[model samples]
Target: MRHRHQAAPQQAPWPHRVKRQHCRGLADEADVPPAISQDWRSFRAALVAGSRQARGGEQSESNQTLLHLQDPVLGREAVWAHSIPDAEQGGLLLATRQAPEVLMNDGLEQAVVFLASHGPEGSLGLLLNK
Candidate 1:
């Protein structure tokens, strides 16, 4: 029941937040069936979608849920490096998040910090500036 967002801290750089744990989660989820885990492509799309959404976790998450798509291509780039090993990719630049604001935990009225997650409580993000 462990999650990648567990590494996310309220205050941490985006790079550090994108630890191996996140990649490992992505890799692990890739193996499971869609019934158990979300499809890799759909998951990535949700992240980059242009609307706020809840992250995949418990069924009853509050507004603290983390997910908001801004750009699918950018999220695709960012996720590719983590989900797929370099050996499989055969040498490519690391994918990075180019947008400033990312996933939101709640409605637009809620505060959204695109820096990190709630550390074991929710998702974390890499700094858009960094």
Candidate 2:
């Protein structure tokens, strides 16, 4: 027995639509690679933990540093919050010894990246010490 399928009529004659639909159907949310998914989970957890720590009512420790200011009257010094901010535009990404050698293929190792844009969409950077 032979069965024949009929082609559906196109609302608009956009040839690329079929290809886009086919590609979208080939992968679903669960298709994300395990390593990337795990990394994302870890990053989210770190962010949540950092936020909770920042919101805690614990007073800053009395660590004296060059940036601290001393009050002669109260004999108290200001303690600045020691937190590394999240990545932002105009920030620099410095590669360290822990950088993988494979990054040398793109000259990213031992190099610095000047982030031009960083947002939910993605990040764009230019290599400074490449």
Winning candidate number (lDDT): 2
Report the C-alpha lDDT of model 1 over 1-130, residue by residue, as the tens digit: 6598686546745434465565743666456778547465566445544233333322323312332255545544533222222122122232224322343322322232243334444455433322
Candidate lDDT scores, in order, read 0.39, 0.60
Q: List the residue pairs that clash in candidate 1.
A: 14-126, 14-127, 48-69, 49-69, 117-123, 117-124
Per-residue lDDT tens digits of candidate 2, residues 10-93? Answer: 586422234545564575547878765767646654665678687874343463432255545343542222333588676678
Candidate 2 residue 116 C-alpha distance from true site, Å? 0.3
State the displacement of the C-alpha of residue 115, model 1, in Å, after optimal TM-score superposition. 8.7
At residue 75, give the lDDT of candidate 1: 41
As a TM-score, model 2 comes out at 0.33
lDDT of 1: 0.39
* Candidate whose TM-score is highest: 2
